[model samples]
Target: MISKTTIDNVFDTARVEEVIGDFVQLKKSGSNFKGLSPFTDERTPSFMVSPVKQIWKDFSSGKGGNVVAFLMEHEHFTYPEAIKYLAKKYGIEIEETQQTDEQKKQANERESLYLVSEFAKEYFKHVLFKTEEGKAIGLSYFKERGFTEQTIKKFDLGFSPDSWDAFTNHAIKKRYKLDYLEKTGLTIVKDDTSTGTATKMFDRFKGRVMFPIRSMSGRTLGFGGRILTNDKKAAKYLNSPESDIYHKSKVLYGIYHAKQSIAKEDNCYLVEGYTDVIQFHQTGIENVVSSSGTALTPEQIRLVNRLTQNITVLFDGDAAGLRASLRGVDLILEQGMNVKICTFPEGEDPDSFSRKNSLEELKSYLEEKSQDFISFKASLLASEAKDDPIKKADTIRDMVVSISKIPDVIKQEVYIKECARIMDISEAVLFNTLAQLLQKEQRDASRKKRSEKKTMEVVASEKKPVEKVDAQYELERKIIELLLLYGPKEEDFEELILETDEKGEIDFKPETQTKTVFRKIYLDLQEDEIEFTNDAFKELYTAITDRFMREEDLKVDDFVKVLEPEKAHAVTDILMEEEKYSLHNWERKEIYVKEKKHSVSQIVSETILNLRRELINQKIKELSETIKQQGPDDEQVNLQDVVDYITLKKLLSEKLRRVV
Candidate 1:
């Protein structure tokens, strides 16, 4: 269990912008910074970070959160893990009391997988440098590939011994369970049918050079292994099979290293393998990644899209594989990204080419060869067509299909015109073909979705209806915005109240001051048991209450920083949604009343004060009823006097203009 003091300390020290900046590259956009949405596929940046409020919101995906929340959402880290990550980054020491074995056992499965992966990484690193066989084989292989010591360490290149039981034995010695090892696909399990015997095993990446595949946040999700020996039977490269923690389609190799550079340059250089990324990055072209030798997937494209919309694909000109890879160009365009292709000279791939050139020379070579996908494809197809009308029509249809895949109408129109110019065809003809393709695809997709829905209906008999999301959140958001902006100050206003007790008496009471009234209204809200319906609003409310109860101070700037990212974003969005209207100097803004002028701030304070006063009076009346039921106790009367005097003093203070 972590103490409240520790949690408070974590909140006090962690800055939302600073923490999120580690993973997201944000450039200044007005009062806030904007970056590609980390949660969605986007061509233009819609992820907004407000430094003033220390919160971020991705308008594209509606995923916003404080720093801790970002880690929780993006990296799948728990609250404690996020706090620990921030503490480590900022060099703050953490103090923990203790945890039971059961509590430790209850830790999430994904986190345990992460822990296992992290442990394996360290073990492999140790084996590579510390063990004689690992040093001779793994270290030599990497060095022979022209990898520097720094590069080898940066990528955590490692070796697993030829012995089948080497990793399994070591893991067991560490008291790590084989169940998780098998679950993560790090170990293979076998059950003998004849003998009715069962045995767990490890075979996924045995006896190979290990390449760790990391997620966007730099945590190892899986491993890729390359066999050095010329084994005719076994495959050259083997990757970890799909597991709970790793999905090949959803991940891209080298993303963790290249994310910042991609955002900085607003472009990602795509290649085709693990070595390509390493070699390119070593050559100081840091904004490069690979599809890890898989077919280009939309999910992979989206990963790159989150960092940049401009992609330059590097290919080996001599290889037939280059022609085969051209399909990915359309995939890139389909995601509404700017696609450029740059092929190396005959007989050189990105790996060899990068190794042979200096950083400046490589950059210059790429600059000179880079061409947009449209021109490159048209010119390439033109040669294949050889002025044959039939082949040319086919080529035009292919281009039209690519154009149809673009989600943005404006981009689609622009691309159609460019394609027509390049193909020397009429824009109308190309548009007609594109429209046909788009319609076909939409109908096919709808049919497929309906078919899948039928299967789901059979498996799940019923579905839960979405509950109506209350709009009271809007009101709470407005109130929080006002509190954050003007909680410290006071304002004057008028109020209406019954002058007499339950017996019908008349009395004089003063209007509530703005700050005081806000507080009173805020407390009355608690008494009335009204709750914020928005999840983010609820989070913000809890944070506000925590701060208010602890410090007795409400600094909007400070409180927003303490909230989760989503809540912080909700607060910030509301605060900035309205246009700035100024009452020049001391000209007060008015609120509508019974055909009379009322200052806006004064009305707010008065409303709060009146609500709180009404609540107190209600409580006093209940006590009076109880007193009438029995003989009056001196203690009860004393408490009543205290309440009455406090209310009278509040009214008098408002009348004398002493508070507001």
Candidate 2:
């Protein structure tokens, strides 16, 4: 367990924007920062972070909380892991209590997988440097490839021994579980039933140089290994199988190291392999990542999209490889990002070219050689078409198809005009082609929707009915919001009291009481025995009230830091819900929005009265239902109860100045 003092230090030192900015690209928007939501695939910016409140809200996915919650949600870190990550980032020493055996076993499976992967990364690095076989094979290989000792260690490069059970035995001997090793694809366990021998365990990356594939946060998720020897029966390069931590399609090589550079440069260099990324970094180009030779995926592109809107894909000079990679450029355009293509000299790839050039030479060549997707595609296709009318027409149509993938209308129009100039085609013809492609896409989408609707109609009768709004739930949520926002502020509240007029009749009068807002709310709810129906709200209410009982002053930002993840998320959602309105700077447009603090007393009194009225209406409803199933004697009693409840509700409505 992390000590409380250390946790406080972490929260105090870590800035919400700085910590989250490490992962998402944020631009200043009024008082807060806005960026594309990392949780959802949206082109528009819906994620906002408030520095004053020290919280963030992703309006797209509805996930909101403080710094630790962002790490927990985005990186899927355990609570302790998130704390430790922050402590490491801010350079705070953590104090810990020793864990019992049971406590250690209680860690979740995902965390266990992460621990095992980290262990493998360390073990491989130790072998690469400390063992003779590793030094001779792996160290020599990297050094010969022009990778300095600094670069090799920077990437945590390593080697697996040729022996079948070297890594597997080492991990198990150190108390790591075989189950996790196999699941992470670091070790392969096979049954040997035919030979009547014990099950065979082997290292998956045996005799291969190891490259650790990490997440954006720098956690080792898996490995990619290259074979050292020519073995006709084995794959030349192998990657870890899909696991709980690694999905290759979503993971980019060198992303952990390149994110900051990508954001700083406002451009990302996309390549085809791990060596290409490392070599570019070695040549002083830090803003580069690799697809690991897999086709580019939208998820992968979105990862870079969070850092920059510009991508320069570095391709080899081979015609076949260039054609294959051109399709990925359309995917980037579809994401509303700018794409540029740069190819190397004949017979040279990014790895060899980068290794051979000095930092200055490499940088200059990239700047001068890069071309926008429009010019590159047009010229390449024009050469291939070569005076054939049919092929020329096809080439023109192909450029239009790529232009249509862009989401911006102005960019599409600009690209269309440029394509016409380059391909010697009429602008009108290209516009018509773009229109036809877009219409066909929309029609196909509509047709798919219609087919899905027909399929859904068959089971429409079995679908659950939509639920009506829960008035009590909303009222309870408002109560929590008030407590969180103005809990410790002193205010004069109008408490409704029962009194008698000159005649012997009952009347309601307002009695003024000065107290803290939290105290007022606490007394009212306790007086009525009201409890929140929503579990999250209920927990938050209890937490806030308990804090008020123990302390005179409460800072919402500091208070939310100590809450459990779900309750903290609930608090942020309630607190920042109104902050969104202020994000648009409506007040600057002469459309001033009213501040809630100005009428806190009225809002608090109305909320309590409304809650009371809602509870009475619920009781009246229950009595009415009881009246339906009762005998004559019971029916008269239930009817009288309903009548009394209605009278109370009417009085409450009158107090609120609302018509029933």
Q: What TM-score, over all chains together, does every model reach?
A: 0.78, 0.94
Question: Which model scores highest in TM-score?
Answer: 2
465 in model 2: Cα distance from truth in Å?
Answer: 1.9
| Model 1, position 628: C-alpha lDDT score | 65
User: What do the candidate models score in CA lDDT, each in turn?
Assistant: 0.75, 0.91
Candidate 1 local accuracy as lDDT?
A: 0.75
Name the lDDT of candidate 2: 0.91
> lDDT tens string, model 2, 1-660?
999999999999999999999899999887889999999999988899988789999988999999999999999998888999999999999999997878867888888899999999999899999999999999999998999999999999999999999999999998888889999999998879899754789999999999999999989999999998878999988999999999999999999999999999999999998999999998999999999988999999999999999999999977775776799999999999999999999888999999889999999999999999999999999999999999998888888989999999999999999998888778998899999999999999999999999989878868898789999999999999998789888898878887777875567877888998898989989998988888888878888888888886678789889888888898889988987775566778999888899989889989999999999988998998888888999899889788777878888888888421
Q: How many backbone clashes can be found in candidate 2? A: 0
**Model 2, position 40: C-alpha lDDT score:** 98
In TM-score terms, candidate 1 sits at 0.78
